[model samples]
Structure formats: structure tokens, C-alpha cells
Target: MSTRPNDTPQTLIDQVRDATASGRPLRIAGGDTKAFYGEPVAGDTLSTRSWSGIVNHEPSELVVTVRAGTPLEALEAALADKGQCLPFEPPRFGAASTIGGVIAAGLSGPARATAGGVRDYVLGAQFINGRGEWLSFGGQVMKNVAGYDISRALAGSMGTLGVITDVSLKVLPVAPAEATLVFRLGQHDALEQLHRWGGQPLPINASCWVKDATAPDAPELLFLRLRGAVAAVEAASERLMQETGGVRMDNAQAGPDWAACRDQTLPFFTPSSAELCLWRLSLPQTAPVIDLPYAQLIEWQGAQRWLWAPASAAMAIRSAAAAANGHATLFRAGADGAPGVTRFDRERSVITTITQRLRAELDPAGIFNPGRMG
Candidate 1:
């Protein structure tokens, strides 16, 4: 874990420049909280956590620009002071998770299905590319519809293209009120209800449907979060309960329940054994539940599903997901790793070609977090 001292943009630039000249690759490390994500990397460490802080925050304009190394909690606290928040509800794997890592990892939590992902809120970005040249894209203003959205493209890129230095994110005011409703139903029935509700105007913001893995015959529970105007939330709560025989969850129970799911603290995330791996499936909400030899936890109204299965079941799971017009990932693998397996879903050839071309144009030297997203 040896790393170069990079406390400023210039120092980081110098390190990257030296790496380029020496024909060496540099692994971008900000907060180092998400090291387990994606493919394991290899390169000299380029630490950016030292260069941190909020650069600009205009609460009136609902935009906050911060150094990439700024902690996610710090940014969220700042936004909370203004009664604003990141709508996508990005998760923090560690207490020191940085804004740069969040964007690079491109992961969003429960609200992602309703409010969009990291990219939607990314208004602009500044980064250092493979050639050690600083580049800027997009802007903080909402009306900035001028060019190709390179800033958004960097979201979920896993730092393969460049090293992010700063980012401009659009924020929204905190909801006036919120509530959680729970329903007990089979997986098929729960998914059907979720899709049916999607067509109507509801205050639903986030959802999770999970079954008891220990007892296959046990009933599944669906937790739905509603957030918006107080009246709307209350109205939706009453209507949903009556329609689905759902029970409203008390705040004492609701808060920790949602937090557990968002942070993967729930039992579903815990692997059963050394040979078990956590798999995440992303599919269309309309896709039906597929039969798999593993415990399943459905989320995002069925668009995102989690399972704990043996490492050898990767292909079977992926195939089932593909049949349902979705894809799967080996989110958390067992002790005996699945060697040579690409963690991410294989993309279409055209999409792969375009991605490769973009990588070549932005990181021809393959110096910035090589193979991180593959």
C-alpha cells in the first residue's frame, strides 16, 4: 500500500506525469473505502484523500462543488444544514468514503430507482487524464446543456478513464415527511403490486422485498418508503395499507430497517460460508422472478435483486438473469475466488467497442486504475 505524497492537484499531476514517463500505471485511491469493489487492481498508489474539502456550495442554487477527496458524510452534513440532500442516496462503505470514490464507483442506494443515479446528479467534473493533463467538463448551473455529458460518463467508471479531482453535484431539499409501509406476500405477488403501483402517482421513494432464507416456506416481506409533502405521504400510506393490507412501520423500526438494507447490514448480505458469494442482479422491473438455487432478496421493485450462492453458480445465475433481460455481478465472493471471472456483466460488442475507444482516447497509456470496471 505504499503511496506517493499527493496533497495538491499539482503534486498529483507530477506523480501521474512521472508514472506516464516511466511506463507505469497509477491506481487512484481516494479514502480507500471501496477497494473491494470491481476487479482487484495493480499499480503504484496515487492517494488523493489529502487534497480534500468543499470548494463551493450555493444552497440557494441547490449545487455543491467539492474536492474529490472530501468525505461523503461531510458533504451530506453540509447539505443537511441547508435542508438539501443528494437525491440518489449514495451508500458509504466506510465512514471515510470520499465523494471521488462514490462517483468513481457509480453506486446509488434505495432512492436510485426513483431519483436517478450518481450520474443524474453529477452536473460537472474536473479530472487529470492519462497524459497528466487537467480537464473540465459541464458546469454547476441547471441550464448547462451545451456539450457531450462527459461529467456524467465518469460516474460508475471506476476511475478507469481518469483521476477525478473535483465534482459539481445537484442537490434537492429534504422531504417534508416520510413513512414506511410493510406487506407480507409471496415474491410474485409483491412484485406485481410494485409494478402496478409504478404506473400511478405515489409518494414511493424506495423499496425492498426480502424472504426468510432459513425457512423457504416462510412468507416474504416488502418494505416501501414514501417521502414527499406530509399530506401526500400520509395519503399514500393510508391508501397503500388499505389496498395491500399493509401495516405502517413505526419510526423506531423503519429507520434501522432501511439503513440496514442501504448499508448491507441485513442478513441477506451475509455470506453463509467460505464458498458462498453474494450476487447482484439488475433487471427490468417487469421481469419476472427466475428460479435459482439460492436465497433471493428483491429490491428496486424487482430491478435489483441479491442472492447468496456458490461461486460455481455464477454462470447459472447470469444465464437466468440474461433470460429475464437482466445481468448479474459477483458482488462479494467467497474465500476461494472465482479466478478469471469478469465481475461485471458482459456488454454488447458495439457497446464494448465504444467503451474501448473512449478508454483509448482518455487513457491511452492505461495508467489510471486499469481493469477496474471489467
Candidate 2:
């Protein structure tokens, strides 16, 4: 079991104080597994690995508080022992991923649309702001309304707001039953089916549609997962398979496939060329097929879409996403690099002004992860 070193908090506090006094930027890192995400930050490293351990867990209360540097796998293991889980299913890009990095990245897996996102599970947090002050917001219980919004905001802040020390999150018991169904349908048809089922009282947990590249002729396939009470899952499985002419996928094969999709290890995620960049489009679930000429893997019913395109097509992709009432992000830059393409979309003036004001208030010295969100 990982243990939190007694001096870790004060050590970090002193480091932040020194950095603030000298006006030097500090890059807050935990495990460094997600270093590839967001814009690169140039600064002296402030590692959170030493402040690691589970602080509190109440099985009955369904809440766990852990030091930010605790390994994500460790926390998950502890929760599994209690038959509880983080419903958002945050992706662990690497074995060394820490809970802190999970919150900073704020990326969720397939179950996100139904189970919610990282921000939804966050109950509270403790962190060090730019003024070298240690502050805490919210509380361990869900009913604790004080400063809740601020704590939730830290979930996807990418460490630009402050150095997160620890966080409290809500957990849910593992579903009593689960199953996966496979359907051979094109993107449009699969999305239509998903939308229809989504409006019903089904146990639908996640849905993924992608072309099977390994097949003789690449055919689009939809993989759907259902989780809930045993009766609910079983009933939904039968109804979905009957209505969609889908087949049941054996858990032995389906489990790992879902995991692969979550961690982005599926064959579809593999780039065919170094110049191809991975773009993530977030649209309304009802958004129709985009007109862009690129292979896409649709998830979250239809709210999230992934495609590989060159940086040269950035404008076209962004335009299509915006036209669909959504936005596109350069999730992963190609090996050849995107000469001047920014990772995130440009926020409107109002949102930008609010973000700037928040940053100024929290990180007054601008010493923490400067330009990380851009």
C-alpha cells in the first residue's frame, strides 16, 4: 500500500512560496503519465508523487478521499474490494497514472454519457493556490453544498488553477449484471437505433460505433453495453438483440474490447500515418453524420466522435463541428506536428473573460501551468 510522507504538504507549500516570491512558473505533475496532454509547460517540476495514499473511505457512505498522488490503479483496487467503482471510468493512459492526473485530464471512458463525468463524481478538493495558500472547498458528503462548484471546476482545470493536494469523490456499487451486444450497422443507422433506445427505460451503459478494419471489407459495427440489475440487463439484452438483429458477445471477448476502447488501445485508434492527427468532436447526440471525409469512431451515443485527419484540415473539421452545434479539439497532435494548430478551440469572449478572471483570482502570480489549457 502507498503511504503519504508526513512532510509532503509542507514541502510543497514551501516550494510554492519560493516560486511565487521569485515569479517562477511551477509545473505540477503526478506520475507524469498525462504529460502528453494539453500544451507543454516550461517550468521547474513540482512532483506530487510523495503525497500519496488513501485518506478516508466509508463503504456505507459511498465516498472516498485520497491524496492526489495516489496511483489510480491502487485507488481502483481498493474500491473494487468494496464492490464500488468510479462510474465515470476515467481512462488510465498508463500504469503510472495517478488520481490527480485523472482529475487534471478530466477524460472519461465509454460509460461517460450514462454514468456521468469526472466532475460529477467530485465532492470536494484541497489544493494550494498561487499565493502559496492551502485552501479547501466543499466536503466529503454530497449534501455539503458549500464551495461545491469550485471543487467541481478543478476536475478539468488541467492544474492551471492550482496544485491539487487531495480530492473526495463519490463511488457507486458495481452493477449486479452486465452484458454487451454487437450490431452490424452503418454509423447513421446505429445512431438512430441508439437514440431510439436512449429514450426508453433501458439499461444502456455505453455505445461505440467504428469500422472493423481487420475484416475482409471494413464494415461498421456498433458495440453496446448494458449494466444494471440482473433482470434489467437480461431484459434489455433480449429486447435490443431482437429489435436490432444484434448478437450477444461473450463476456470473455467483450470485456477486454471495452477496456481497449476505454484506454484508446483499439485498432481503430492506431494512426495509419504519423502526419494524421486525432481530433475529438463533441456534438449533440442527435447530430447527423458529419460531411467531412474521414473515418470516425462514434461514442457517447453520438456526442463524441473521433477521427484521424491531417492538421491541414483543422479549419474544415472545426467548421463542421461548430455547424453541428459543437466543437472540435486536436486531442493528439501527429508525429509530424501541427505547425500552428492549437489543441483547444478558441472560447467566446464571454467565456474567455470569465476564465481569465478565475485564473487571476486563483493563480494571482500565474506560476502554475501557464498556458496549459490553450
Candidate 3:
């Protein structure tokens, strides 16, 4: 992949200004790895891949400022060199995944339940709004209060608000020790145990419960990851195994499995049939197992659930989510496609009004990613 030399924000500003003046909708794109995420947008492509590279790095301060189009792999490699990592573990769907796309998509990996979400690490942002004017929020330091909340809000905005030019993200040193424990338990038992452990001072960083499709009898298994000081991890691992009859996994063998879970490369993510759509249900961690009849994978200590079912099951799935005081998103359409279903759940009237007002203020012309989030 050849790098483009036009790494300055001026180039993006000029393009946005021209688009705004002509009243033409512009679809913001950085590497386009997450193009399937939201509703499709009809507009001329506005590429940000050319505006890439790290702007600054302060290892001691645990913050790195990088341009929007910088490759997510490159940023992770740089941080790894300094023994630091992004705590949220944002998923890189492919090698082409960009830092800007990570923020816009606002998706996090396995560690999300314990560490934080994409918004938590964002400290500042620079973007070109709908009018093609360069606007900035927050600052490089964590304590910079002015516009801090707004900067964080950009995470997961799906580029509907503005074209994110660059951002400063908070980083953390990698944990000293880690362990994965596996237990053969059903989904309900697994969730119950996780909830029981939640009240304890255990160093549980991530959890996943899935049925082994390849196994002879397809037993449901719970995988737990513990990360922290060496002593803490070891102690917790031993106690949990003793109490629950769990088996400790060799990191050499378990590391890649965890990565597969994070990146959704696990076999479970693959649709068994072309008609099955992928639905993501975000619920309270304490919510019980959903009574839906479909293949399911539970993550985030039960806060995030992935289910495979036909689009015809949309009403039942959405109702179940709503009953749990949560929301469901049509994460990925099946090969047959979900014709009329929206990707996102409808917000409450108040939230809908506030969202409309925010878009109106920042993207007055509605020229940026017109239908991407709708």
C-alpha cells in the first residue's frame, strides 16, 4: 500500500468546503474496513487515507496523538515498542483498519468489560464539520476539561457528526501477567457464576461463553481471562479453578483463541446458513440468558451478546433486548440481506430530538455521511 503525501488537514478542509458549497453529500472513509457497519450512504467518497501518520507520543504521559488515517496496526506496533497498549483493545477487522475508523465505529474487543470503551480513552479530537470549518475539542492531556465530553462523544458517532482529522488517546502499560481458565458449564450457569464473581475483587478482565460447535457433543464452555500483577493473576486463577473445576489453558494456545474472539474470526461468527443475520444485543451484565431460539455467543461478562438468526426474528430479538432495558443492533446482514430492517435501534423521543439537534448544529448541511447512522 503506497502512502499518500497529502497528510495535512488543509486538504480535507478544502474538500469538505467544496462539497458543502455544492450541497453534495460526502461519505467519510478511512481505509473503508468498516463500511458494512452502518446503513449504506449514497455520496461521493471522501477518502482520509492520505491524511496519515503519528503526530506525537509521550510514553511517560501514556498518550499518543495520531492522524485520522494512520493504520491501526501501525499505531499498535508503535505502542507495543514502548510496552504500552490501548486498554480497550479496539478490534481491527482487517489490516486496512484505520485509527479514525476505530473511533468512528466505536467497537471494542475482549477487554471492554473490565478496562473501558473507545470513548473512555479519547482525550481530544480535531475534525472538519459539515460547513468545512476545522473544529477542535478537548486537549492532549486527560485533565483538559473544556470540550472533553464532546471529544469522547465522537467515538462511535459513525462519522455522521464530522470528519475526524486526528485524535489523542490515553494508553496504559501492558499487564505483567495473564491467564485463561476454561469451565464446561451451560450458559445460565456460566452467567450466574460470572455475576457471583463480579462482586469479588477478582482480576477478571474478559469472559466468553460459547458452545463448541466442533466438539463431539457440543458442550457449552466458559472462558475467563485474568490479567494483573503476577501474584494476583496466579492466585485468582488457582482459586477459580479449584472452586469451579476449571482447566487452565496454556497462554501459547489460548492467546490466539482470545484474539479470534476479539476479531470475530472464530468459527462461531460464521453464519451456518446464508439466511441468518447477525444481531448484537447490549444488555445489563446481570440480565438472564435470552429465551430466543438461536445460536448465541455471550461476551463482556454478559453485557454483549451475539446471536445468529433470520431477519424474520428481528421483532422477537428486539423485544427481548428492550425487555432487558437494552437495545439491539443489526450488526451484519446475512448474504440474503435484511431488506427493510434498520441497522440501529430507534432511540427514545428525547434522545432522538437531542441527536437531531446535535447533528443540526455540527453538520448543518447534512453533507457528511448523510444516511450512515440513520
Q: Candidate 1's residue-wise lDDT over 40-69, tens digit each?
A: 889999988977888888888999888888
Q: What do the candidate models score in CA lDDT, each in turn? A: 0.88, 0.91, 0.91
Candidate 2 lDDT, tens digit per residue, 109-130? 9999999999999999899999
In model 1, the runs with Cα more than 4 Å from the true position are 1-8, 215-218
Q: What is the lDDT for 170 in model 2?
A: 96
- Model 1: lDDT to the true structure: 0.88
The lDDT, on a scale of 0 to 1, for candidate 2 is 0.91
Candidates, ranked, lDDT: 3, 2, 1
- Backbone clash total for model 2 is 0
lDDT (tens digit, per residue) of candidate 3 on 43-67: 9899989888888888999999888
Order candidates by TM-score, high to low. Answer: 2, 3, 1
